[model samples]
Target: MNKRLLWLLFSILFMAGCSVLSSTDPEFSRENYDSWYDKGEYQKALNHVNERLETYPEDALLWNEKGYILISMEQYNEALQPLEKAIELNAELDSAYNNKALAYNETGEYEQAIVAAQKAIDLSEEEPEQFINMGNALSFLERDEKALEYFNKALAIDANAPYAQYGKGVSLYFLGKYEEGIPYFENYLHSYPNDIDALWYLVYSYDTLGDYMETIPYLNQIIDNQKENPINTVDYKGLMLTYAGELEEATTIYDGIIEQYPNEAIGYYGKGVLQIQQGQTDNGLQSLEQAVALDNSLKETAYNDPLLSSVYNDELFKRIVE
Candidate 1:
């Protein structure tokens, strides 16, 4: 009776310790892969997967997972090998086909992406991602009508699928259906609010439609989200404000640009044009001279600009530009 009780106690303790043991030993647990991956420790996740593969090289799931890890690392070329290997090991591995399509898409091999995505779609049901992959590749190939069909298939599967909406938007945008594309981008932004590409699409659509004022707010949003200096975006906003007749606001933008980037020829060039338009010709001429000194090309631009026509005959302006 005592021996039986001890055996039961030992079994209970061993089962209890198993999870803790597996959490440490990468060789003993698959959960560690997800633990590292879920935390965005992609290199650690890759290392863990690679370490396990050294022993269980035939493991198809691990091979597929390794491919996914490489994709997450943006190592698209490296991802293809393991993804192919996974499919070789298990012909029915739908996930491997999907991942292979994604890697091919990033590498600019659109035909291969479409082929792999087709395979994934055939192997799985209700998977919008594969449809999106095919749509993206077809769109890249200038097969907009065909691509639209696939995007529509994805949308039919999930009406609110953001990626499908984005893909459809891209097709329509390229096809000159800017007005129709607007709703799809808007739908996509509903899910991915700050998506830079979608925001730029909206900007272009509004600009192309001659709705200049509509573009200003979106441009401002893009400028605000820029991680780098955003000097170009700031210039765009300043130009847009000028077009909107918000002269004071535009002047402030130019001043800010000059202060932030003192050596930038564009800031001085923009400031000089605004100054000329606002009848600050003397100050404008000086700024234009400085701009021409920094970038000789702006001399030709100043000569051609209608805003400086009033000062065209000015001796100082002729000395600065002509």
Candidate 2:
């Protein structure tokens, strides 16, 4: 799975409609605040909250709302002040604790996140979201077994919670229970059909399990969605295609990559390995030599690649790789 995608998903649950605009803001009503937030105008919403707090400095809800807006803007560090202030004003404000946990998690303060999330859960045990948040925090600390336990706890409270499903799937996958992880992700996709993070991991789990055929459709989806960053997926798709026995298609992909980036040794190395595996020894050896000449570091990888095994005993192959 994509590491960026996991980081993004881990801290995403807290921003789901946690706005708390006051009905009594005569100068800036809740309707106006809601409109700005609903239309993705987080900056405007943040400004409105700041303006409101100028008059009502004691409003815990406004503090929470400001923190939520800052979070939407990806300003996790800026979000903490208002969130802590919210908790300071109202000690029982579970949402404030939950949002603080999210901010802390995003900033790589996993220990703080765990403490805040547990506080939120203590205040509102019935709220499944706090459990999910706590699980995500634990997962970030590489305590996946503990994360799975909290995820299951959240699922018991709200069986259809999408984040809980996603967290459970991630924890299970990391724990080497790939088959068990599949249903959790599949169930989440039923509700969130276009979740690329989940789809990417589904592809990864299947690929790791040697179910190359099962990974094809999701791989195609990722490839199509990644057109703007073709470099990220092109070589990976080539390797996956090779694994699935679509050698001709894989070679075509390598050819396109080599043409697009002639100086890059990876394209040549991949092409050489695939060619050698396909019985084109002479052409493959030449390609490998060019690859090694361009980037000598590739010699170590080329030496170990199983695709070059056919020529393992051949002195010509040994010399080029060495």
Candidate 3:
């Protein structure tokens, strides 16, 4: 009887010890999962989370962390399950809701994202980042006016909010208030000189306002910063050819581009403009025809092209535009 009792006691003690060890373990599974996440091995991180969930099913923080990892991977649909579970476990987990909204936004579910973002904003109180995120969600929903309001709110909370200022500029640009947009873009550039999107918008705004001269310096800066960025070089060349009146230099650059990218429509279009500017009618018409055949998208601007304006009444020009 004593032998049996001793064995039973040993078994009970062993089981108790195992339970304590498991409970006191530093969540090594979560640590491994995070390591995978930091390495950009998102699928591996998610698999680790699933394994941990089997052992710690009631861990709300683990579920929310998993949701954040899934959102980073752009696995938006898959992210919803864990995030919803997190919200169910702890209604006050603001980051879970914020991550859920990000996932919704990634999946193009803008309305749902807006609802989720609003919840996050309520939880965040006066946080500027939350307001900026809310503005982004509103922008995706085509509620530009409301988006601008949120952007302004974000700026009020944090005057140097880059995302908010950039959002405001984009909204204003879409609303056709280019003049209002320009200052915001300029402000963003003052702090973020390497912002390619802002630089592109600044160039576009100046071009639209017939202040092409002002755009040249920024384009030059972009080219200097990014040596291999072909788009900036091409845009700069086109703008210089149009407004700078350096036909000979423009011709040389366009010819080089055409030789490098024979099938590219922009190079042909550029060359055609250069030819027309030099009074080479037949060559210009041929180059323009090649450009149109390569990509008909250039047709809209062909008529309004300053170089082609001189030949507006020409029969060949009419045929090409038609």
Candidate 4:
């Protein structure tokens, strides 16, 4: 062959090789989706997995990955079929069943989640997550004692498992053993300090045990962290004044709560009561107005609260709460 013709042939071969090595190509053999998935960039991961699935539709691992991603996205109903298909393709794939359990759990199908989690436990290579899934399902079904067994099993497998600790704590909590639940909750919180759910669980447990002072700090943390908190901060203020008698500390906590969650009425309501107790009459009244402006329900609260008796007839207070 002529030199020019040989060079053109080499260029064509190299271009074809590079084309075949792209990430989407089934023959390319890269774990590209893992990076996206691990980084919590699910959409990018899904797109990448979908590209591979287009070429290798029967791949069990890819289908399982797809199902898990959908679950993580909270599309539980959508995740089911892919997970089922993964199981169909590879009956022994324990992780697929585990993923299915999580999806079913989210959909409130506790019985089905238990069934899938059991299969995962049977097939998994002693994975603590499998037991934790089983425990969560049982707990959701209100069978906390039975859930405790599974959570303990998970703990047996991995002593430092955060999910297992949380599960054990929740089971103990539902069983009315608040004191026993405390340590496990603390253990879980050690791993996930910002988890609102765990923090709330700890607060409720402390409140039930009459550990009013202990509840205050967690309540403050929840108010600062939770965007749509369901907790009644006004009631928390009452607990602070009535049970804790740490008015100064409570006032400072409420101040931080107000600063951290400026738009929430509860924080302002809490701070208002604290200010009134300290005899900052004008500041207290202003806080009350702000509270009622944010949530009209606080008006009724302010009017009924004993702590506001002296201010009940104050014109600004009457206009604010009444």
Instruction: Judging by TM-score against the true structure, name the best candidate.
Output: 2
Q: Taking the tens digit of each residue's C-alpha lDDT, what string does model 4 give over 120-180?
A: 8777637787787778778877898999999899899889988789889888988999899
Using TM-score as the measure, name the better of candidate 2 and candidate 3.
2
Give per-residue CA lDDT, model 1, range 1-322, as digits (tens).
1211111111100000001111122464556756775688989888878887888888777788788788877788998999899889887778788888787877788899899989888888567778887887787788988989999998998899888898888888878898999999899889878766778788878877867678787888888887988998788777767666777988999999999899998899888888888889899889999989999998888888877889999999898876
What are the TM-scores, per candidate, against the unseen true structure? 0.78, 0.88, 0.74, 0.70
Candidate 2 residue spans exceeding 4 A from truth: 1-5, 8-10, 16-34, 190-196
Q: Comparing candidate 3 with candidate 4, which one achieves the higher lDDT?
A: 4
Candidate 1 — which residues are off by over 4 angstroms? 1-35, 51-56, 279-286, 299-322
Question: Of the candidates numbered 1 and 3, which has the greater lDDT value?
Answer: 1
Report the Cα lDDT for residue 300, model 3. Answer: 79
Clashing pairs in 3: none
Instruction: Please give the RMSD to the true structure for each candidate, in Å.
Output: 13.7, 2.8, 14.9, 14.5
Top-down lDDT ranking: 2, 1, 4, 3
Tens-digit lDDT track for model 2 on 160-240?
Answer: 988889899999998999999999999998887777788888888898998877877776777777647666467777887
Q: Report the error of model 3 at residue 297, Å.
A: 6.9
RMSD of candidate 4 to the true fold? 14.5
Candidate no. 4 TM-score: 0.70
* Model 3 lDDT per residue over 1-322, tens place: 1211111111100000000112222464555755775687877777776777788887766787687776767666988998899789777666677777667766777688788878877776566665666676777666878988988997898787676778788777767788898888788777778766677677777777778767776776676677574753664656565676767767777877788888888888888877888889889988998999999978877988766889899899898888
Local error of candidate 1 at residue 190 (angstroms): 3.4
